[model samples]
Target: MAASVQGGRIGNLPAEANAFVGRRLELAEIAGLLGAERLVTLTGPGGVGKSRLALRAAHAARAGFPGGAWLVELSELRDPDLLTNTVAQATRLTEQTLRPLLQAVCEHLSGAPVLLVLDTCEHVLDECARIAQELLASVPELRILATSRQPLGVPGEHLLTVAPLPLGERDDAVALFTARAAAAVPSFALTDANRAHVAAVCARLDGIPLALELAAVRLRGFSLHRLLEGLDSRFDLLVSPARPRLARHQTLRTAIGWSHELCTPLERLLWARLSVFTGGWDVEAAEFVCHGGPLDAEEILALLASLTEKSIVTRDDEGAAVRYRMLDTVRSFGAEWLTGLGEAEAVRSRHRDYFRWIARQGEAEWLGPGQRMWAERLTAEHANLRLAIEECMTAREPETALELTGTLWFFWFACGFAEEGRTYLERALRRARAGGGPEHTLAVWAHRLVTVVADDLEAAESVSAAYVWLAEERRLPVPALPLTGASLAVRGESARSAVLYGSVRQAPAGDGGAEFFQLLTLAVQAYLLAGQAAFERCAAVAERLRAECAKRGELWMGAWGDFFVSLAGIGLGHPDEAVLPAREALAAKWRVHDRIGAAAVTDLLVVAQASRGEEELAARLLGISRRLWHAAGLPQLGRPDLSVFHREYERRLRAALGDACFTEAVRKGRELGPDAALALALGDTADAPGP
Candidate 1:
């Protein structure tokens, strides 16, 4: 159910499977399972090359199911709860599923000719089977190729019992091992001297692919006689002549055990501790989280790097960060090793604290607009952030957990992650309320207020009590508490909003909340709503800042100020005065590349241009504005409270245009309000009817 930062693992279908070396008969056998039967279960003992065979056939036949072929690997999954998510991911379904995910799977797959390759289903047989049967029944065009130890038993499932690679003369297994061993260690060839022994070993092992490969690894070091001396005891011996019927089937566990026994002690320790990380870790993270008695951070990093070379960890192709993760088989082996070492919990806690410190550093960088880029860096480590929150709370380190979520507010909002933001904020607030440190409450109130104001007035007021609590506390960061005033204003409590802003103890005029952005927003609201006189006084201070923006060519923010100024001008009925400011808003929008704001400002410009008798341009610009707004996904009217703006447009259009054309324009603008739409469509109302 959780999202992973670990680079995803994709198992390759054997190369010969693609070339389909000597398996034309086998391919036809599997192909028959797909026709008339929606489910084909591939049952085989471990290392019998089941996955390679099934996946290859599915890949070859992918053209028939134009919908696509998807592989859902069940090996890495530790929790059965994750079954649906894994399937969802494999099918490339991005939307959330509330009903059982299996039902969602059917709905998504229904009538879509798709072949799903369900690999390694033995561990989660029941969940996999339930999904397979539902898919087979509901999806007319869906088929499955499942690899498991046992049959799914779902109706219409044709069992294709996969055998190991053929072992006698002209067999694929002996040839593959000989080729791979020669490639892995060049000087030591699989000549006639070792050929006889290798073939005998393959027969004894029932030609299991995994066992053959492991045995091939020893050809460089051990003579055939020496290897045979240790053969029966080693998993590769596979010489169980008396018990050919064992269900153990000379399995994955034996093959993995032989690999684990070869690792040095330090390497083994590193492997075990690395499992404490929920996702793969970067070198620095591995150093700190897995540090131990003899292994310092440097040694841990080196060990991780070394493990990658040995295939214990897979290195990622993405270069933003060099990271490593264990393969499913190796991870299982490492987990067992970790339990024996008895250090899982302590390693997990260290991992949590490492991320907490990262959050603290991130908080300092989030203070200014530079925060935007810093938030991006933090984003790359999101899984670590989530794991830190989860582990810290579970460990009762709520203080650190609260800060972790609190500091990431910028990333939560700016990155189109609002729903995710709400989730973490809720978690942080609860922890802060329970036993988190003092900053928690401030953060909780701030996060809640942002969510409320952005979503709805009902939400803003829902947490009014929290705002009142912060006001009483009056901390320096209580600027967040004062935001309740803005929320209240949105809810029609202008007077209360005024009083709260006025009540804030101001520093000297030039102090300007000493570089806090919240103070700037608060000061802007308080100054403007405090009425015309207060706005004029504050405009002088704003003028000084506007000069700095002009100097930097930061037309965007300058236009933002002009927007508020134009609104003030319109309220005062000084159309002539509003003209330059409204035009400036348009310029600012284009200057900063704010398309949404650009379209909005064009509407305002239409009203201004009409007031100034620019009818030809106003009419054409209105058409452009309408087109832009439609394209921007906001085709409706502007914010609900802009009636005065509409009236301004109507006044200009009526005065400058004739009654006949004005009447037709009025007919068209009628849907949007004859007043605003007329100003938007045909400006210049010198002889127009009164609003």
Candidate 2:
């Protein structure tokens, strides 16, 4: 549910999707607890609105945390081992170092005033508690707000029990029902004629928000009187004889079950199958994974619409695209039914297979006009991809898992997820080796390339010799040759790197997508040229690469091309010519969530400004670049060639401005958020210091 704010920092919290009808008192109390307590847990039964309240509270408290407020949604996450990595990603803490992921996250957060919201932690209670305890112990100014059905049992945890809405005349539950009822049927209202019936229905459902919402959807089909009568009969039939005291959760479950029973047979089938998805999914995904046998593929859209009308599925139409999701409680109910039908594994297989196709398609089309679209699409489906990978691993389909993970190397490497890619690749490689499957040579090389980008040279080298031998034995062209050249450049082997890059560029276009390889080759070649002090040649090659990217309508590689052009211009001592390309690269990189690329360009901007004798502005830009590099988990991308330029520029700026003035300018820049820094770089000058 995280949304990107253009020109600003990425917001980890979900935007309010709809009107919040009630809970003024609970909100006030939570605001107070957050003021005094470091850890506040909102405990309640399922569908009692804990997540909604927590999100609202986090948004209210966001301004207090200069480090930013982040929400780590744990509901879709199945593996307890991934908790730390998931949290780190939510905080935008990339890991390109050899340190443990937790240590990296703690280090990134140390001394920062951050509010971390761990939503839906019941499934990973023990792990969540462990992480929370460690983070609290390490970060002095950090606060945590967690939502779970029960307490996490961590020290210094304050529990706030969230109860069902008070059923008073104008209380939350009735107001919630009325609001949802109006949405269901615009002409519907709480009239004098049906006031008693509305109150009867709310009382029947025990004021649970989810139940009320579901019941409100019935308004489109049934009269208020008939709906009340239906709920009365349904509730009585659903009560368990063993537990005469109908618990609150049981009441909620009965409501969901009643809604399920009312769906058409096809709608019910699709509902159960759709449970295979972890996060929200789109129409294409649902059709692919949920259709078969009794449910025809062509009927999926209509069935999905029916399910949405019945409140079994919720639609998100806020953006340009429409997506759908079920409440966690509703999804759980469908999962139980899915397991009962013995179709869980089959549906999950289809889910995995569908995402596998997505990975393959993304890889196939990565070098074309659809590059930006693929990047955005894959990012949207990231949770589903992770779910599919988990399913493959759970089924012991390591070969398939490796193929899927390997095909997504571009996503992991170019889209700011190299660290996570390394994790999945390592796991798949281990499992594939243990399974005694065919030596997946392509996947092995892909893993090595990702490791190199992640700054794990030792791991990258481990597979180097074997991959080369295998590729030659099988007569397979090394598709990763350009990246191999990049690896050499990172190690300061400019001469050798240039030779490799030249061979890749000169090779005839083969079946290995040579056009893509050539693009990469040119990028690295330009870098090598710049490092070797051939500024004019570097600029010429980079301009050609940028023009190619423009013709192909590609943004990711085009941004890199712009970066190199700017680098060459700065190196050639034409600082004025460097500024536009630097800004262009930063904007494009930010569009694709390429933090490392943006950081690199920001660093280049510093040098360009310094060479133009704008010493104070250069110092400020330097500070901004430092923060960006830290967030990216790499200083100068851990590349010695780039680091050398960074050091030289900083030294020159410091000498020109002297220590005190330079330090003050950098301090001001470091305090600015991503939005401000970007504005300053783009010549807004509003936040610039006076001379």
Candidate 3:
């Protein structure tokens, strides 16, 4: 199952939503180059339609390769280390295992006649080149079509440089303008009255497709004659003499600069401030980050509408909300203006503050019915959050950096970014230590969480020691202590975990919902390891926590509460009572992308199934759990309280299924994707039905 979009022919080469205007000769040459060479690199300036041309070429050339043509968008990717994983994901190699992700990708494409179209590789140029070279070397049948600002510089790479649309009597640029104008202004047409004027405008804009479209959108208000006159004046003012050789670049800059000059002061201000966002921002986010000073909160909506009208920002209607974003080139221009005005630091400070609040709110609300919703919103803003973190670090604002990084612990962990989260946390920690200040409670908590998530026992001990002192100094009942106990238990230190839990106490009733759930999780794990008497106590606390969560509408930890109940039922020999709660916990964790938690719950569900004498079903779930654990990047640290029974269940299932069948069943589970695994664990038959 390749990652196909809504409109595609062979594999995920997206069908053009808007009619492609004119790239006839370029397309012909590209097709020839692609056929002649296995790796064809498309090089061009920004806004020159490099990505569009590459995509069209890939789409047209799809039939040549039997395995299909696939496009992996690299514009939104910031981490080079994830290049292989991202490509694999695009190709839908969904198996989760401990193997190197690149090896998995090589295994998928090895000797397969496939065409991989890598778009926007300029940012991760080196990494993309390395990947392309490795992949092509191993898979002789693989062809790579990459678009970048320059060539990939790999061996045997064929370069095709894309230039702007040609002007003159060809009318290609004019045809493009006319088509877009008709969409923008339905009554608009290319007649003898205005055909020359439209051609002149296209000539002024250097026939750049992006520039022409941006200019075309303005037809809603301006007559052709007046638009041409205004472009003449703005181009003279914005054209830099130093870059005369780069005509298309200058034309694009002039076009964007002209758009900026046409904006109202408030619109311009909003544009500059909006540059702070890396991805896109909704009206709500724009209002929060761009308001104050001369721009009032109420005025932001009107100004944003104006910018959208002028094509300074593009509006995206995703799901239920409208998001506004600037193209990369446009955003860069705005950022330069912001820096010129000496408001760069101020604007980024506001950005960091706004997103930090978002992180804290998400942390507080993650345990409720809105858990999945918050996760989705946070995922959408991930780029902005990363930008904010970078701003904090670069500005030498350690306190802010520490707080922001710490606040995002739940988001990073629950969203399966544990390793990346650790990187940011460590950076912030070094900054804090350099500043010679005591670590704040929030920062300490964040570090401790990261340490535990990364399974770094040595770092966990250091972080917990620091947190313990900070919690006492502030007289705050840190929720992270019990997390430390869980980490200890994972390290096979049940006795030490028991001793640690002896000192850890539940937060006061009025403390917070998250803290209470944290306490309950510790109670269940720590006390169960302590023995049967402590296990009963743990059961009572679990019941209380579940009732309170249900009463208060807490969803995330309430599911964990369900997990605890299932655990108690297993320990108490009530397998029937365990099934439903185990399923409930699995569903909740799956919804929030809690891979580690989901894996642990799957293991518990298998125990319950085995207890019901369903040995085959139990064996299948055991396989699914292994897949889940691999996805989590964590080892199977068995539940200390039930390890004996859990092992016995595995042993009995292996004997019943036989070696070959058991291995096949496990492979079947490994093949079950995240969604199907969740469905199966929750008692729904997989899409194909049957194990």
| lDDT of all predictions | 0.58, 0.80, 0.73
TM-score of 2: 0.91
**What are the candidates' C-alpha RMSDs?**
12.0, 3.2, 5.3
C-alpha TM-scores of all predictions:
0.58, 0.91, 0.79
Off by over 4 Å in 2: 1-10, 191-193, 240-244, 318-320, 434-439, 453-498, 501-517, 547-551, 639-661, 684-691
Worst 10-residue lDDT window for candidate 3 reads 1-10
Q: Compose the digit string of candidate 3's lDDT tens values, residues 73-157.
A: 8876666866776686567553332346576577666534789999999999999999999998888888899999998999999
Candidate 3 to native Cα RMSD, angstroms: 5.3
Model 1 scores a TM of: 0.58
Please state the error at residue 47 of candidate 3 in Å. 0.6
Better of 1 and 3 by TM-score: 3
Where's the lowest-lDDT run of ten residues in candidate 1? 1-10
- Candidate 1 C-alpha error for residue 72, in Å: 4.8
For model 1, give the RMSD to the true fold: 12.0
Clashes of each: 13, 0, 0
